[model samples]
Target: MRAASKKRGIEVTSISRPIKPSDFHDFDLILAMDRQNYEDILNSFERWRRKEPLPDSAPNKVKLMCSYCKHHTESEVPDPYYGGPQGFEKVSSMMY
Candidate 1:
């Protein structure tokens, strides 16, 4: 991922972390790369909701990342970890 970003003149300095319930409050939008991820986030939100009250818009904040794509018809950002270099490039292109 870092290599792909560097190739595009983007600096990747942030460490990866799991989504937290608090993120719903912190970010205006939370994009999921794929269906599994999208479902996972919604499921997580449900679990958190049982513990406390969440914003009514919390569920709406989660979305599929590729839904914003203008040039590509992809529905989700593919996981590049197993596809090697080409996979990363494909994801980078979709994001761009």
Candidate 2:
């Protein structure tokens, strides 16, 4: 996917380490794959917000990854772990 994105003139960032609040300043967006992570992101941001209040432009930057996902329109992605591949595939079909 990274290769494909590059071929199409898109930039791909892959995170291989723990994310810290300071990292947000370098990226245009920070999308959490699910709500749990979203809350984690929010909580961390809040900690930063206490020190540096976010500008009005901030809210538009932080978002759940599902918000941009073509598949899950309901604001949350279903857990596919217990449901197996079929569940994950369902989401894949909707997305692609």
Query: lDDT tens string, model 2, 1-96?
Result: 344445546556874566675666667887666788778777777777788756545545678767787644667666655556666555444344
Clashing pairs counted in every model: 0, 0
In candidate 1, what are the lDDT values of residues 1-96, reduced to their tens digit?
A: 888978988888998799998898999999899999999999999999999888978999999998889979989888899899999988887776
Which regions in candidate 2 have their CA more than 4 angstroms from the true location? Answer: 1-18, 48-59
User: Which pairs of residues have clashing backbones in candidate 2?
Assistant: none
Q: Indicate which candidate wins on lDDT.
A: 1
Q: Which pairs of residues collide in model 1? A: none
Q: Estimate each model's TM-score.
A: 0.93, 0.55
Error of 1 at 28 (Å): 0.8
Model 1 quality (TM-score): 0.93
